[model samples]
Target: MAASLKMSDDKQETEIEEGANTSTNASPRPSCLTPDRQALADSIMESVKASVSKLRRGDPPTIYIVPQIIRRVKEVAYEPRMVSIGPYHNGKERLQGMEENKLLYLHSFLSRNPDHRLVDYLEAIEELKDKARSCYSEKVGPLMGNEFVKMMVLDACFIVEILLRFYPRCRKMKLVKQQREELEQNEEDLGLISAMKKFLFHSNGFEDPILSTIGMVYLLGCDMLLLENQIPFFLLQHIFKMACPVKVPHLLEKMALDFFESRSMPWNEKIEMNDSYYHLLHLFHSHLLLTPTNSKEEPNLSCIPKFKLKPNLSCIPKIKPVLNKLKNLLPCSNKAPLLNTKRRRMIPHATDLQLAGFKFKKNEKSNNILNVKFSHGVLEITPFLIGDNSETLFRNLIAFEQCRLKAKFHVFTTYLVFMDCLVNTSKDVALLHHNGIIDNLPGSDDDVTHLFNRLCIGIFHNFKGSYLSDVKDNVQKHCENKWNKWRASLKRDYFTNPWSFISLMAASILLLLTITQTFFTVFPYYRPRSQFLIIMF
Candidate 1:
């Protein structure tokens, strides 16, 4: 239990150190809790304050946002519940992530011990298999085997690893439907192998420690759960939880408030806070937090007072298609951002384009700048974007397998940053047009677009320093040009089309003639001369 406290306390300790170093006469760090419930109230307040501080500046560069794949051993394993299908008329309720993770593990365990004679254990295993299937069915309904089954198998494999390590003995029983032929009759099958042969050697899971090293890959994530059962979740949770808060809780709180005031949470739904969570927020605020990499520098809110421009619905693209899926569940995101200035804007669902053929280049002309060649036949970094430095930064936090997660995350983060830069630019252009600043625009549309891409390339190249604050305005301008061009294209397509009308008329006449010919042919004497000539020939 005290392990959880380490995250908070360590942060608090760091802040104390910072203060002491800054001021020789700085007060000593606060004492630890005395384990009294009375102190719990105060402790909770302090904790929340710390959480709030971490929220302020955005995540720190050192903060680990990387998705983790930690594996261990577990002593207790159970399938608590199964996720059911949603309403028949509508849909079925799907399994929660945690639930799916558990069932997937259960199935793997049962497969390992297929010969287990215990009725209750066998029944439990059977129930898990069903639940696992239901979970997939509810999530995807019916999917072509190639697409969805592949994903389910991967999911199951990951979950099973948790069990394999937890109960090493689970391997003795056989539970999987498709057992390996080579390792069928022996104890050599200790772990999972690459299910897909073509991608086998190159796959991230191929390097999974338990299987490649040991051969049996069935038990991976389960090992971690078993160890977790012994250590307690609160301890680990506490460590990661208070990393930011203890360091800069006050700063984080102010940042959150500032973000909320600025309307940065525009597209995201509002997050509700409970008492403990609020306390965590407070702790976050106490620490001095780094600004988010993409967050814009506030342009003297008081100096440059708020101004409104007329809305431009004509320029609005079918953003729903673009904004449907930005839903990557941030790992261990306990606190919600109070900042969301563009709430009116659409939140985009990231469509993975797997953009390839990137060329990395350095800019010695400026220490904190670099360039990258993009694939959409153009580069796309103005002042606010480039490669996936975010992934690199988070990689240090939650290390993934052989840095494959790092690579994938880099690609994803890079795409997002590029898109974000474009979006901001588009909005800025619309705003300028509405406000009559079009005449005094910053630069030519082409130049602005080119500059935006250059800036993004610089950001990606200059990971050691420089984020969006270095080039946000230029990026905004560039996106405006792109948006205007896109709007013009849409208008042209909708309003001007000679071929469409002609095609429709021709099709209607052809359909009428075909029907008339069919009716005449059935009358026995209405065959066309071409048909008689064809028969003679």
Candidate 2:
């Protein structure tokens, strides 16, 4: 009986232990309270939250200056001189004189709207400060926090007031006249430019004893073109709205176009200037290329896929054929075509084309610089008015294109590249100049040629969507034609002058006599030679 009780007690103990084991296996440990696991989970959650926050900020499109491009070109071309528009050049000693003018303009703007407090302008600028900073590719440094906002406020109010000055009603106002007088006085005080030099200027390259108003305006205009020196268009619009509130449609656009009308092209007159432009430079660039009419003639590269090569070594039967294929695939291959559907091509320079019997003529009616055409041995290019500010204008435009994101076509860069290829030397520039296609007002032909050669040194141009591609192909084909070569040879060798013609005729006669002598010498034993000798004897 004692042994049976012991066995039963042991079995009960085993069953109880089994039930405990079952319970332990069925119920998971509460991980929520576990230190290590909870810490890991919390870390993962924090990481996800941080990522979401970053994603919400999104990637701002790059609208700032490309350092690589600026380095390749002249640094002075992208810099401001008389005035600095934005934070990039804000506080420079050279441009600080203009700061006083900016402040006075802002003061005038506030005075014009007596009901509007200065705090209202500050609040509007403050609201746009973060968004404006985000537009630039570089981060707005901590040093530029409040100072940057103040600069924007001052600059925006100044621009609006300047634009307002052009209005007919605004021009007649006493305040406007007084503001103009103050600006003139400031310019005179700063020795910026004399009134006589300002009024005397007509052409671009006219020499003046001192810094003229024309020079100052050109420099200031160039400074405004710099990518780093741009204020957001919306910020300006916001300030103009709060200050003007005149319900004038496209007030800023009208003001900008009127201010820089010399650089404006008639082709873009129909284009609606709305909210698409990011800044003044962007607006000016759009004015350079965009048109309202949709034409199939305009090259579209969107459908074309970028060229990429993949070598399948395993499928090749022989190394020789593979090597041959590779040679053609390589961009440096001499046998390969210089231009293809996927790549940019270079055409002969203006001098070479002229030598090859290609006639260059300027299309006076066409105001668009991109409207270049080649057909039936004639190359027609729209005249480009090169000026003192052209270098600055082109360099800034190129920098803008270089740093742009999702840009479908680089019209300005392509034009620069095309011109670079055409103007290889002073002789080429002279040809273009003599043909009235280029207005060489800035400097000599050599200077213009050198400028163009260096302008597109580091810029890349895709010919697929470029209007110049067709012109290039036609010019290349005409240059490569055998008949054109023969004609050029005749022109150079036989028809250059009276002396050249006489020499060529003399050479032809000498060649005929030599051929006759050679024929007799080779056939000395022939019947023809003996018969001719007997007849002569």
> Which model scores highest in lDDT?
2
Question: For model 1, how does the per-residue alpha-carbon lDDT over 291-395 read when each residue is reduced to its tens digit?
Answer: 222323322223323345685533323322222321221112232221221343222111101011111122222211112223221232322221212222112
Task: Point out where model 2 deviates above 4 Å.
Answer: 1-59, 142-144, 166-215, 264-267, 292-345, 405-407, 489-502, 513-537
Alpha carbon lDDT of each predicted model = 0.30, 0.65
What is the C-alpha local distance difference test score of candidate 1?
A: 0.30
**Candidate 1 runs further than 4 Å off:** 1-105, 113-158, 161-414, 422-537
lDDT of 2 by residue, 1-537 (tens): 989997986786566555545544444468644556555655665555544444457846445856774555687777777777776677789887888777666666776655578889888788777777767766544326788788888888776666554434542344334435555466453342332122112122323212335555545556667777788888888877665523346767877766666662334555576786789888888877863221224223245354456865443234445456544543331333222223343676676567667789987766667667766767777787778778878888887887783445577787788888788889888889899888877589888987898887776667665656666666666665555655665665456478767766765665556556655655565667668789669
Best by TM-score: 2
Provide TM-scores for the models: 0.20, 0.68
Tell me model 2's lDDT, rounded to 2 decimals. 0.65
lDDT of 1 at 503: 48
